[model samples]
Every structure is written in C-alpha cells, then in structure tokens.
Target: MTFNIAFSEVTVTIGNVSVDGYTEDIVVPITVSNPNESVGGFQFDVITMPTIINISDVSSVNENDFSADFNIFDDGTARVVFYSNTGEGIPAGSDEVVLNLHYNGMDVLSALVDLEGFNLTVSDADGDVIAGNIVDGSVTIGNVVFFSSDIPDTGDVLEQVSVDISIQNSGLVGGVQFDMYDTPNYLDVINLTTTTRTEGFQIDFNELDNGATRVLLYSPDNQNIASGSGPIANMEMVVHDNAYNSNVGVNFENITITDDIGGSYWVAGVDSGTVTVTPGYIEEPHNLQAQDGMDAQVLLSWDPPYGPIPSDFSEDFEEGVLPEDWITTTNSAQGWFITQDGSSAFWTVPSHTWYMCSNDDMADDDGSVDYLITPGLNVSGAQNITLNFASYYDGAYGQTAHVLVSTDGVNFTEVVTLEPSPEWVMETVDLSEFAGLPNLHVVFHSNDNGAWASGWAVDDVFITFAAREIDRLVHYELTELGQWALTAPKDEVMSRFGGGLPHNLKVDLSQPFLTENRPVELDAFKVYRSLNSSTGFQEIAEVGANTTSYLDEDVVNSTTYYYYVTAIYPDGSESGPTGTVSATPVEW
Candidate 1:
C-alpha cells in the first residue's frame, strides 16, 4: 500500500457574493494529487451548516474510466462515492479533478464546505486504503445593507445640518456600526442621534483619534431583532462660521452591520454628500435717488447699492409714485407715469391697477415718442439676463411700444416690438446675449403712431440679471421611462389648449425649478389658476418635486382657466410664480 499522495484541494471559485432576495447556486471543485499507483475509488462526506448552504447536486468530472453517485442525507451532509466504471484505473503521479459539487444558498450568511477526514476513504484498483490530506473551501452569500441619501447642498454659516443613515434591505440582524470622518474645516459634528432602534439594541459612540472622527455602534445585549430597511441614525453638525467654500466633503467611512446570527457584514456601497457654505444675507436699504438725465455723458453713479442682489429682480409698480431712480426723457409729457385706482384718464382695473401708462391724452401729443429707462443695472457679474413685464395696449396696431437696451444711455438697441391688446398680457424678452455689461439699461419707448385707444400701460416689470434659468421637471400620465434627462422649462405664458375633465382637469404639468441642491431641494410646486387674467388666482394643485406635471381633473366645460406655478423650497420658502398660462376644457 505505497499510496503517498501530494495533496487534496477543494476550491470554491468566487469570493463573497451578495444574494438579492432568493437563493442562488454555486459550483465547487475538488482535486487531488496522485502517487505512484493506480486509483480505483474514493469516498468523502461533505459537511456544511444547514442554515448557510445545502448540497444540491454531486457528481464526478467523468474521467475516461470513472463514475460517481452521491446521496444527500437529512443531517446537512452528502456522501459522494466514486469508482472505476471501465476496467482501467486512473494513472498515478498526476493531479486530477475528483468531483464537481453544486450548492444552494440557504440563509443570508457565509457557508463553509469541509470534507470529514474520519469518514473519507480512498482506494486503489485493489480496493486498498490510500493516503491524502484534506482541504476546505467557503462561500459567503448574504446582503451587506447600507444607506443611500442626500443632504442639502447650500447652508448658511452656523446653520444646523443633519444626515441620515438607512438600511438597504431586510434581515435578522444584531447591530450596525460605522466611522464618520471628514476635514473639520467646513463643519463640526456636534451631536449624534439614533433615528431608529432595534428591540433590546443599545447604542454607543466615541470620538476617535481626533475630534473629526466618530465611531457609532448599535447592538442587542442578549437577543437579536429583525432588521429591515429604514433610517438607523442621524448625525447633526453646525456649519463653521468661517467656512466660505463652494463645497465641503462629508463622508461615512468603514460602515458595517452584524447579523443576528454568527458573522458580521460590510456595506456594499456608499453615497457621499457635500455641503455648500454660502454668505449670509446682508440687507442694504433701498434709496430712491433722483435719476440722472438721459445724457450718455452723464455717467450715472450707482451710489452704494444694497448688498448682493438676487439673480432675479422685480418691481410690480405697487408704489403709487414712480421711483426717482427711473430716468425719464426731457419730454415728460409723452413719458410714462404710474397711476393707481383709476387715477389715470386711461384704462384701470379695480382688481389689478397700479401700472405705468403712456399719456392717453392723444390731444396732448399725437404721434409723440416717449422713453422710460430703468436705473443702471450691474449685470457684469451675471448670466441669462431677462426682462418680463405686463402691459395693456389697445391703441392702433402701429401705435406700439418698443423695448430697448443700452450699455451706454447714448446708444440704444431695439429688442422687441409690442402690439396692441385689449387686455393686459404678460411678456418676456430674452436679454441673455447682452449680459456681462456693467451699465445695462432696459428702456420702454412708446410710439403713438395711430389713434390712441388706451395707450400703453405697463406693470410688474422684472429686469433680472443672471436670470436663473428655470430647471424643468415634467410629469406625464403615460411616459416611456420614469425619469428623463434635465431640460430647461418651456417658457409659454398664457397658452390655452383644449383638455380638462368634467369636474377636474387632468392637466399635464411642467415646471422650471431644480430639486437637486441638497438641504434646500425643491420640495414641490404650488399651482394657481384663475378664471380670468385680471382676477381669481387661487391655488389649484400641489405637486411633488420629482413630478413634472399634474392632472387637474377638477373643472367644467365652457370655463377658461389660467395657470401659474410657484416653486416651494425645503425651508418653506417659495419662488415667484411663473408667468400665467391658460387652458379651457370642452365637451366632445
């Protein structure tokens, strides 16, 4: 019996694997080194924990003259027996594959495969015992749960910032622990709180190495609880007073969770978050200084304007008297003047008055040209300049208003021509191409070419520098994909289409607001509608941030509806409403 074998090796090809929900299959191979003798048969008992893996199939690799038969017993063990089928036995002094085993994952855990040396036997062609050493292999099949969430991007200095942790999946678990680390230059974690707790699980944490590193842990003392997906913890930090960067890095490192059973598992992935430190709001008083004459050589000085102005600026003409900052041409007779409560001889609505009007006294100056220019605006540091204004014009078609712009009041360029409308209409003009000019001017020059029916009445003028481009999100009833690429919202003001329900209309919605910036994500959009343009604007719907549109099936036929959108932020703040659009429902 000179059967001296080199080694017996059992190897599982892959390392740790994550099981999604159900069981998965794995293949294991066993090989052996032979001695200077022919081999005839071999027998081994495969053992594994019943809660980890179950032997499903066992078979020989089918050598030239060998066959195998295996029987899985109730005791979580398998007996595999191999013998020479044909007369010729396997040659010696070579490494050969002895068997291929198939295993089924049982629970969410790691399983080991071992060959019991006491019950294992090897024989030659003469049915005599042979010698060999045994080796084992293992496979880990389980889920490594973790949290994936976002935090607000922009935060004021000293503002409270909090981040949450959540589990990705469900399993019987003991506890979870992780170390949070980051450069303390932006913010300091002042407190750690548990949002969720397992039954009988105790929570503990300690500062590590430096104050910037924190270790958090939670586990049950005597028993385990079924753990599932939800918030597990929250870390609150205060923004540093001196933090003045565009972005700060915050990360959760070395996150791990333990099973209620035997071993612990690490998170499969992690999504890091960032915090942006923005300057605090500095209020500067609004001073109505006397406007300089429209002489280009005057070089009007913008005396100590208020602190950092918003990207978008607006004036609704609510102030009965025109601001002195607005410059007027020498010919004041034909220039613009603010009128309130039917004060002007021209048109005025009780519900919506307070507008600047070109003198409707046609007898005073027929065919007269009047120019009303805005205060010198600082657009040198902005992008996407836009001008929006509401106007009422019922004069002859040729008797119109021309919107003009100038960097120097001396040289002006025409941007748009407005036609006469019996009712008030809101209009937007793109001034993006002319941005970055320091001394920018928006001028409304009116030409009374024909019969002055009601002259030009303007209100709600918004001259926005670096006009924040509306980031659009649209929702549809039937879309091919759930989420689509980002796009700028459609800028259609007061558009009427045919579609609405008998009671409420299922209106498709699209908005131009962003929801990505953390901490201040766009939460929702408040929808407003009016029966007529001049009156009755009421909130009709509230849609989520991720949703693009809403179906307003609450309406009646033959009734016209005007719609507007206001973006709501996380801090209960709201952006100005979008220009109103109209929709009317009709019976088929």
Candidate 2:
C-alpha cells in the first residue's frame, strides 16, 4: 500500500534595498504567497555578508494574529519564527508581508541576502508541511574614493610636480588616509596640502623608507567634507634627475576613509598620474654668419635653437578615392564622396582637383546626417596642435556644417561651426586642448535638417604641431662708401678709401615667433670670433636678448675673420655655436 500527499506551493521572497550610505535601520519585507489559505506558521533564516550589512531586528506583520521571535547572530544572520497566536491561519494572498527584517549598513558595498534553504519551513493550520520556494534579495551602498585621471604635466629634470587627488562620496567624510607610491627611482614625494574642498581639514604625511608617502587628513572640529565630487587634496613631488624622457607614475595604496562617527567606508577605485620629463640640455643654434662691412668691421648674427614645424598629418584627397583608413557614416542616400566635377549648382565646390563633398542637394532631405572621420592619430607627444582645411559651403534651407574632435571614436565635441560662404575659404582651428590625446580623431559633419540645401566641400586637411620659435637674422647690408665719406675729410678718405675706413653693417632679424612647446627664456646673445674657420673661437661681445647685430669694430682692414653666435639662458647655459661664416673687412 502507498499514500500520496500534495503540499501547497508557497513562495517566500526577501525584497531588495539600496541606500546611499550607512543607515541605522533599513526595513526589508519578507513576502509570502500561496494559492491555499492555510499558512499558519513560518520559519526562516536571513543571511548576508558580514562586512556589508547586519541584521538589527525583525517584526511580525499581523501582530494581533501572529507572534514573532528572532535571534540575531554576529555573522550577519537573523533567525525568525512566526506562529499563529490566535489559532487563525493567514489568508491566501500574493506577496503579503509576513515578516519585516531590519538591517544596518556596515560598509560601502553590495551583498546578497539569502534565505537558508535547509532551515526554511512553511506549515498549515494542522502543522502539515507545504512546498516552499525561495527568492533572494540584494543591498547596495555607494561611496567612492579615487584619484583624478590624466593629471599630466611637463617638466625638466629635478623639477617639482603637483597632481590632484579627487573623490566622490555619497556620505560626509571626516577623515582619510592613504599610502602613495611613485615609479621607483623616478619621483620622491614631498608633502600634501588641502584644497578648496577640504579647506579647514588638518593634514599630515610621512615619507616611508621604501619611497612611499603615507598621508592622513582629518578635522579637529568634527567638520565633514560634503558629499560631492572634486579635488580634496594636492600632492607635491619632485622628478629625479634621471627621469628625463620618461613618464613617471604616482599611485595610491592602503587607502582608508572614515565617517564622522569613526566608522570606516570602502574605497571604490584609484587612478594614477603621469609626469613627463623633458630633456634638460638646449639644442644647437642655427644659421650663423659673418658679413663684410665697409673698411674695418665684421657683422655677426645667428638664429636660436629650434625644431621645425611640420604637419603631423595631412590629406589632399588627390588619390581620387577615400583612403582605406578613413571612415564615413550616413543616414540618408547620399554621403561624403570624392569627386572632381561639381554637379550641383547650389554647392560651391573647392578648387582642388579631388576633394570630399557632402552634397545635401543630392541627399534625401529626411533629416540627412553625414560624417567623415579621420583615422586614429597618436598625438600624445605633440604640443600646440592645430587643424587646417580648405572648405566651401553656401547654406540654404537649414543646412549645417561642423568640425568636431574626439579622443574616442564616439562622443565627438564640436570645435568649429562653419558659417556660410560664397567661395572656398581656409579654416584654422586651435586644437591645443587635445594635444596630449593619443587616439584623437577629427570629424567633418554635415546635416540637412529635413530640407534641401547646399552642402559642404573640404580639401587639404592637415593636423600640425607648433614648433619652437627660432629667431634668425634674415637680411644684412653694408652701408655705401658715399655714406661713410659724408663725415670723412677728403685727404683721409683719399688715403683710407682703399682699406682703412670704419665699417657699418646693418642686419635685420625675422619677426618674433610663437610656440607652445617648452621654450627657453633668452637672457642674451653671445658673439664669438675666430681667425681660423674651424678653431680658436673667442667670445668677443655680449648683447641683449633682443639684439640682432654685432659690429666687430676692432677688425683690421683686409683681414678675414670667422664669426658665430650663440643664445644664452638665464641659468648660464649656452646653445651650441652656430655655423661659422668668414668675411674680410675692406674699403668699398
């Protein structure tokens, strides 16, 4: 003989909860559901991560009909038992709260609240067991501590560097402590100071033997850093002399954050900063020369040390087709196309033999959007970048053209919005803000907002980096013999006209140049002279930084002298001697 019994299907679920920070009491309902109205008693255990949350108390939903008893454990568990005190079973219902579990957030984290499978029980009025299903819940707490990203600064060897330390806190912060480490042998931490966000906080730090800096910040008056995001502290360090041409990193470890009540919070993330150290020595000077002057002088001039300004990237679209690396996207029938012939009367084509054009007149007018993007360019080493292109656009019927930039392929930012023009015009856009980006991309965007209009044409696109300015003497002329004779006596002029009269040399310098790279300050120009072309050069005179010419009035007529010039820095550093030039002083 065999007997079969069917149990009612009852589901007991724990509800999810989320809070911004630590809370004294958070209520979570334990709901029950069944098709049969025979639930008389229930028992279960709620378990959570001990480090994230703790169960505080439990209560019965129907106090008059049922009585509840709960036991809290130190390991973040609560055992609850509910019984029908009036001998009346709970009515059949969907998602009815049978028990309320209270919890206290322990840290900034997320944890699962699970029902103990082996300890769960659901019984009917007569104490018969019923089939049960369990559903778990979760709790999340929010507070984040991190360093600012891309904190980049350029410096020479043995220079001091500073970087910001930022945070995002959901709750007030009363204190913080962390250990900062730098790239071994590259940087040494000095100290830290409070920023505007932590103006009145007390700060202290100690340099450890292992090249790590341990820092602590707190408030003596129980003041709290308001919950928000910004820099809280600034760290100062010095780059080692051997760190030249290197990108040194500063990182954080062993971080701890505390609230006003002395409870510790979890650190969400951390980021490092990079210090780029440039070479310390100056480059060699260029374009040195000595020019002959009337009768008895040799004029010397030279250009400063400089790097050439060249286009880092350029495209003329003369290949008659789009390059394989470039990309195009469109939402309508027409998009960017390479063509030599201008077919639309409404569009003013560029004068290039081949160019890219987004013709709105040919595109479907249903809100056409088109984009032409360049390949990813590594411009991290470039300073003072710029974008230049030849463009033609005659707008009509709500059409628009824009030049955008992006570090990532997505999420472009408009750098230039083109105005309507009747003919081709050259456009230059300052891209200095994006100079240190590695994977930068340029976008040419066009849109016809649901109406037909003239389109945009572009050619000769270029991305360039500004070079260091090098001032040079471009022109030099010797004063005519008649000018020198104006002040000379007839007998003296007659004797010195062939070889012995004084010389006057006039030299002109090129216009003052500008650059965004590391530019050295000019203290003065040092002029040097040599009787031989290759050796025995001696410093003859020193002139101001703005000086362009030097007259060697001690020269003897008919004697050839070699000369070169160098730029001097305030730190007593002098550039390499410029190219030597030889000239002989002679009567005109």
Candidate 3:
C-alpha cells in the first residue's frame, strides 16, 4: 500500500526576531494521507543547527490515538517518534495533525531547518515498511550573511602555505558551517588552527567527497559572539613537489552562520583563491639562527628548534644513464663511463650505480686527465657544507683521484686527493670553510699520466649538511588489556588486546625530496630500546624501508621502556636517532 508523509507547508513562517532578550514560537505541522491501510507509527528527525534554535518540547496533537517523544543528540539533530496508543488506528484518506514541534529562538541566524524524512515510516497497525513518497520540508530561519577571503594568489612548492576564512560584518554569532576545497592531488592539508573570536570556541573538521573538507565551529557553552572581524580559521597546507610549474585552486561551499537568538544567516558569496607552485632548485631557504658566542667563537650552527637544515641532495644513477645536466670531459678519448667493475661489486655501501675511468678503455694514457663534474647545487645561504662518496682505485703508476670544488664551474679549487685503493673506500670531505656560496660544483678528476692506470670507480655521490637532532616524544599508558604499547606519535593513554597485539609506529614518508613524486628512499629502520633512562640503548629490531610502522611486543608488566628509530641509507649513512618515546606496561 502506498502512503504519503510530508510537511503541511513548504516553509513555516518564522517572521523576525530581536537581537536581545528574544523569545519566539515555531510550529512545524506534519501530515499523513493516501494510506492503503491503517497507520500505526511514524518517526523522523528534525535537523537544525543548535546554535540557532532550541527545541523545548515535541508533543503529538492527536494524543488520543498516539503518544510521542523527542530526543536530541550531541550532533544537534532531534529525533522524534510517534506510535499508536489506542487499539484502532487512523484509516486511509485521514489527513490531520500528526506532530506539533515546539522551537525557541536562541540565536539570530539563517539556515534551513530540514525534516530528514528518510526514517519516516507508517504501518498498517502491524510493523511493516510502507512504500510511498516522502516529501521533506526546508524551513528558512533568518537572513543572508557573507564569507570573505584574503589569501595569496600563488606560492612555491615546499613553501609554507596557509589560507584564512573571514566573516563579513557578522555579529553575535554562535556557530558556523562551511566546506573548504583545495586542488585534489596537488595540495595536502596538514594542520588547521582557529583564529580571532572563533579561537575561543571548539571546531570540528572532517574530510568530504571530491577533495573537500568540512569545518564546523560552535561556542562550547552556547554563547554568542558579539563582534569580530579578520580571519576565523587558518589552514596550513603543502604544495606537492610534483605540482611544480602548476597552480592549485582553493574555494568554499555551503556556508552559513548562526546568531545566538535563534536566527540563521546564509553566506551571500564565496571568495576563492589560488596558489601557483613554481619550479625551484631548493624547497626553501634555510632557517638560519644566531647563537650567543664568546670572543672569536664563530658560534654558527645548523641544528633545529632555533635553526633547521634543508634536505640532502643525492644521486645514484641507478637508471644506468647519466643525468643530462651532469658534466663529463676528458683530455683523451676514454672518459668516465658507468660500467661493471670487479672492485666495486657491492651495492649497499655506495649504491647500485657506479662510474669508472681507466687506461684499460683507451689505447694509450697520453697523460690525460678526465673529469666527472656534478651539476650546480643550490646550497646558497647554507652553512657547514659536506660531500660524501665511495671510490675504488688500484694505484697503478701512482694514479690518484682528485676531488675539486668550483663556484663558477670553470675555476676549480682542489679540496682533497685520494690514493689508489684495491677495495672501495668511503670518503668524507668538509666543505664548511667554503660555505655561503650560491653555486657549488663538485668535480672528480682521474689522472692517467701515460702509464698503466688500473681503474678509478666512484658511486653513491651525496651532498648533505651536518646531522641534526631528530624530533620525537614519548608516553606511558595503562591499557584495557593491561599491556603497554610504544607508539611513535606520543599519546597519554593506550589500549591493548590479546596475544596478537598491534604496536606499529606509523610513519608517513609522504613528502618528496628531489625526484618527481618519489619520496626520500631509506634502506632500513633500526628501532632502539632502553630500559634504564640514564643508560645505553640497545637495538631491538630492524625493519625494511617503506614499512610505515613497527610492532614491539616484548615487555614486562610494570616495567617502563623507551624507544627511538633511525633510518639507514644505501650508502651506509644513518639518520640521527629520532626523539625518544617511553611507555610503561602495567596490569590494571
């Protein structure tokens, strides 16, 4: 049997309200008709922003045949249910008052009070799904307000990006609802913070469909905002490295404001913004900081907190092809060529890619010097520069490899000289004395002076700043299962389960370093655990790279343990241990 349930009118007139000491009554009448059988029960939710209105009571008009109750949830939706009390039910074609909703004006706001009729139902004295058309109602509350913007038009990749949301001439507001949007694949929202008058209230943010995010802010005590301007919220986002040379769009949708006097305000228009991510050699300039110093101290450092360092620049040439920008020159026919060498067989230490130069590839040495120079590195404004690489040489005819640095790439300065070695030797050169230069060119010169030169092989070339402290936090908690879990992102409390427990420290290596769309690659991760806070830490386990988290299960009840993780690179370079985190296992 087909049954139709709908509101009596399109919009129940809620005329007007004063700003202070206001009280008003709003009645919403629900009707039912076209019933193929007797109607026994019905249910629906009155959805509206609580900051705008207060639902004091919801009683049925036909109390002789049915009784009703109203319940409100924290999300501001009121659920109303009415069921038949008498033995007989309302017959078909009977259209009378089924519900009388009572609302009090709490705020002067503007929005649609909706009757979500999806759960609306009618039964023939027996509980059954009734098939019919459920026409919902949309009731407008107040007047139209506006949402404005003052965001920048463009930004650079890896640059700090932020946007602001402002309310235009809004007064005595208690709550707001809006949708925020950004370039789907190019921009990532990292963090959001409240601003101005809204900072005094609580906010809820959730991700929506099609790369949109929703934000709702309301007074904790249901108080009204008297006056405010500027930004209401600040959103921090990042432009992906792959977005170089492209622009990302930012906009808002479905915005509304609610005053404390039971009135709602619709946003007149949404002001949009855009950010253009440009290509650059460096993500951003180093955040240099000054330190207190004594006489002739030169107390400049690249540590974090006060000073932060930039990501390293590295190249392995694993593709078996030299980068087009890399420089290669030779006074003779035989130059540096990437080839398989018996002396440089191992892949882990230096990398999978290696380059070699020797007289064996030429008919005669001719006392020629071959050069393999790297492309210009943008280490401008950087301090304490360093270079690391692996080389293998046989020392035939006293042939040596010379490492040189250049500012103009044409005029070279000899930095270090390497003797012949039968096995691969890792080298570290301190380029700190030459810091503060804009363009840095590193060159490897191999000399074969008309003599039998065995070979010169180099691999895993990397240029990085000095190691800095790792960021981390630790926590201890008692769980329901009575076991302690060591979480990377520190938390106050934790929960545990039976034997197969989860204790993975989730890591998000989502940001790119140099390669397009490719994240920084690590060979492995070493987790260190310590029982005594003042003593040494021992390696507990080692996991492979790209593994986001780790599970550490070994612990004794009532004992406290600390943990930290270090990333291992293919060139045998290890990152500084992350900040230590602690957890105590206790049975409750």
Candidate 4:
C-alpha cells in the first residue's frame, strides 16, 4: 500500500534540534500527510531520527509536513512517520489524511569547529630560507587547502617560500562561513563579497552588531564575482568595516616581511604601524644675547625673546623680561624715555643708532641730542650691517647726532635729518637701503662742542642679525600593537591639546630615544651666535628642554652668525654642537 497525506492547513507544527545528547525546540508549524489506508499511529521519533540533517534530508518529504527547528551552529537529526486514520487495512493510492509536525528551535553553529595552521621559513635579503625558524605566527581566516612550493627549513617566512593549509567548516551552522588566510605578512582575503571575483581575497566575519544571523564576506578591492556565490546579489553594503582585522586581528611576527627594510614585519596581524617622527632635542630655539662696551661707559647689550620659547611662556609676557641683547641704556642725566615713542604709540622704534650730525663745528655752541634707526622699512632679502642707537646733535660739531649707514660703512650714506630735541628723544634709521649687501657697518661720529658735547644720555640699545638653519625629519616605529603619541609634543608644541604655550612644556616626540621604540628626556640646550662671525662665536642663550630653535637679535647685518643647538644630558654631558641655525635675522 502507498501512503500520501495532504493538509488543508497546518493545525500545529513544532520543530526542534539536538545538542549535548538532548533535543531542543527551534522552529514551528509542521504539517503531516498520509495517503495509504487506515493505519493510524504517526508521531515524532526523536530517538529514530538520522544523525546528519542537511538540505538533502528534506528531499523525500515536504518540509511543511516534517519541518523541524535547528540551531545554525549545531549538528541535528530528524525523523518522519506515516499512518492511516481508518481501521480498514493497507490500501493503494490512499490520499486523504493530513500530516503535520511541531518544532520549537535550532543550534547548528555551536556544533562546528574550525582550525588553521601555517608553516613559514624566514630568510635574509638573499632568497634562502634558514632552517627551523619557527617563532610566533598565525593566520586569521581558516579552512585552507594547504599548498607550498618548498618546505621551510628555519620556519621563517623565508624569501620566495611557499606555504599551504587545509580549510573546512566542521558542519552546517548559522552565520558560519570559510576562506584561506595567506602568509602572515601577506595575509589577505581571497574571496570577493559581492562575487567570488578573485582579484583580492575575501574575508568573512560574523556581524555581532546586527541582530540578523548573516555572514559578512569582505575584500579590500571592489571586485564583483560572476558566479555570485558570496553576499546577496548587488546588496548595497553601507559600511564594510575595513578595520575588522583590527577587531579580530591576524598579524605577522618574527617572519621577514617583503618590501620592507631588514627586520621590518607586519607585526601581529597589523596592516600598518604608527610611525611618528620629531625634531631632536638640540633643535629647539635658544635665546641669543650679548653685551659690548664700545667707546667706553656706553653699556650696550641686546637680545631677542628666546626662540622656540618654552610653552610656559605667556603671550602677554608677564615675566617682563627679554632674551639676549635686550639691553637697557641710561644717560648720565637719568633722562626718562617711553617704550613705544612715549605716547604717539602709532610708530614703533624699529632700529636705531646714536651719533652726532651738526650744522656747524663751532667752539662755543651747545650740542644737540639725536639718534637714528629704521622706522618704515619693509624687505624680503638678505642684508648685513644694520644699526640701532640714539645720538645727540651738536651745532659746533655740525650735528653730532647725525647717523649714517653704508654697505662699506666707510662710505657713509645720510638717511634722515634729525630735528634735535632740546631734552632727549628717540629716532630710527634702516640700512635696508643697501638691498642685498652681505656687509654693512654702522659708525657713531660726533663733533658737538667740537667733540666735547656733554649732557647727552643714551640708553636702551638693540640689534638683530638673522641666520636661518634647516632641521631634518626623524620617524618613530611602533613595536607593539596599540596606540601611541608623544607626551611632550602634546604639551610642548603650543597646541590646543596643551593649552597653547603655558601647557606646551613637553614636545610629544614619538621617538623611543631613551628606550628603543620609546621616547627619552633631553636636558637643556645652548645657543651660539656669530655677529659678523669675524669675532668667532659667542654664547647667546640656554633652555631647559629639547627646544630645536634659537633667534638671537644681537647679530650685526652683513655678518654671518652661526648658531648650534647642543643636546645636554641629565648627567651634564653634551651630544651636539653639531649644526648651526644659518639665518641672517631680518625684521620685515
């Protein structure tokens, strides 16, 4: 007798799967059908179900009639029975009984396991793999068909060596997928997400963020597969998490990575490392200052605010201090003077020099006080021999306060005519008129009272010479997997992260100076200056950090000043007097 059952509609269907020797419910709504005669004892036989339940298991009967729940991660089994409602014996072509089964759930994924193994051989620049070179190495995605051209002798990812491994999913599981993970350093996905397009490799992952039991396949390249065996056909992926490798990393270890200098590695599955470079400690700006007592009792000193100034410095300059050559002048008469032209405040005394320029060289005439300095000057080239000072005018000496500047100094060029102030006033003169002259000289001449002009007070003299120098770049390599940054550059670079100056005491240099792949603390630095350099070099400034800059205003125009930043260790030892800052300081 043949049996066939059709249901008008499923009254109730329960589905289930087995795990750890027990049956668990996974799904529902199973229908039953019997077409053979009056045989009537049909029920679910959990013990009699076949061990393996795959898509092929539903071939003999309609899934609606004997459907059972299953875990995408678990291995399960199922069984089906037939019966007749009438007591009449077996009959052929019997077909009026409804067949249905009920199921609750499934667990296919928890029932599977995957494993991968990689065999590598390392080598030097030469393409020879050393023997027995196994250290720490691993592959991310598993289920490979292990293949290798040559076996590694040293276990290193030896040059031009081949490696292979077997890949397989233990069984059917929900959201479970497979692929090959290449060499540690060259470990790339081989399957395309959209298609099996093998341009780049594909990496599959479980989407923990999404509630759906979907397997995610990815490839670095945007290639489409013709067979369309991967992701949903043309399912627009909004975000592909290229950083998933970061989440469930696969990295390279001691194996020599291709295309990098010796010892370079992919390092524990990382795609790229964070390399930070920074200026050495000796490159910071140091204040350059100096003092000279020329022509007696005229205490003249000059200096600019320190270069690469410490972050602790405030913009408002609360310290009320200046760098080297920031000299304060005094007249034997204690004559008072203002900072910015006393009150006009509109004009700033840029540069100046003291001298005598008179209308007459008489014997019985009172001398006038005059000074010269450049005021409205703008330039963008190299220059030397600029002057800064204040002088008095003497009628007997034909204007003793007269000032002059020339490329040769001996060949003087008159700049501005000074209207001698009865008391004492300030003035400026710019030697920038000489354009690109590498040499400029400033001379102080006075015939006031026939070289006897008294009561003239000179104070607050300043000079600036620039010599710009270039610095090199240094890169830091990250040894381990994680995040890194310079603790100093953060607070030392005068950035928002350090709250501008006050917080920039440290330069976040990513160099592992003290400790390899780490950073070290450098002591203070000294700055050197050569005003004309004809006088060798003089000490200009000193700082307490690895400041790589220095600007000394005590330099003379046309004079080449060579400055060098030396790295001083905490033990008071110095490392570099190495290079100089070759800038001819110019205030434009």
Q: Which ten residues in a row are the worst by lDDT in model 2?
A: 505-514
lDDT of 4 by residue, 334-394 (tens): 2222221111111112112222222221122433322222222222354532333333221
Over 1-588, each residue of candidate 2 has an lDDT whose tens digit, in order, gives 532334778888888766666566777888888776578888887777434566777788888888888887776567778889877778776568888887776443422333342377888776777778777776555554444535677777678888888887777888999888876456777768898989899889998887788999998888998888888888888776544245667778888888767776666567877777665445554444454444676655444544333557889787889987898888767788998644353333423346788887666454366889999998888888778776766464467899898777678899888876433445677878888888999999988766666578887687788732222123233245533443344345546544333324211222222222323456777888888978999999997766555667899989978777887765566777755667777766
* Local lDDT at 574 for model 4: 60
Q: Report the CA-based lDDT of candidate 2 relative to the real structure.
A: 0.69
TM-score-wise, the better of 1 and 2 is 1
Worst 10 residues of 4 by lDDT: 291-300
lDDT of 3 by residue, 405-471 (tens): 8887788899988754323444667778777777889998877655544346676577877743222
What is the lDDT of every predicted structure here? 0.55, 0.69, 0.56, 0.28
For candidate 3, the TM-score is 0.37
Estimate TM-scores for all models.
Answer: 0.40, 0.33, 0.37, 0.20
Question: What tens-digit string does per-residue lDDT give for candidate 1 at 1-588?
Answer: 375443333221212233433355666766766657666777777676333566777667775667877887887677877789875666776576767777775454532333343366766667666664455554445555655546545678789877765666556666666776655356777776666454445566677765545545555364554566655666677886645434667777776667766566545557766766665222211111111111111110001111132436677667688876787663434566676422232222212336677754333455345777888888888777877666655343245678999887767899888754333445668888888888898988877654442356677677766443221121122122111100111111112212211111121124322224322245676667677865789887776754434445666655656565665655465655544444445555
412: Cα error in model 4, Å: 40
Candidate order by lDDT, highest to lowest?
2, 3, 1, 4
Q: State the displacement of the C-alpha of residue 513, model 4, in Å, after optimal TM-score superposition.
A: 27
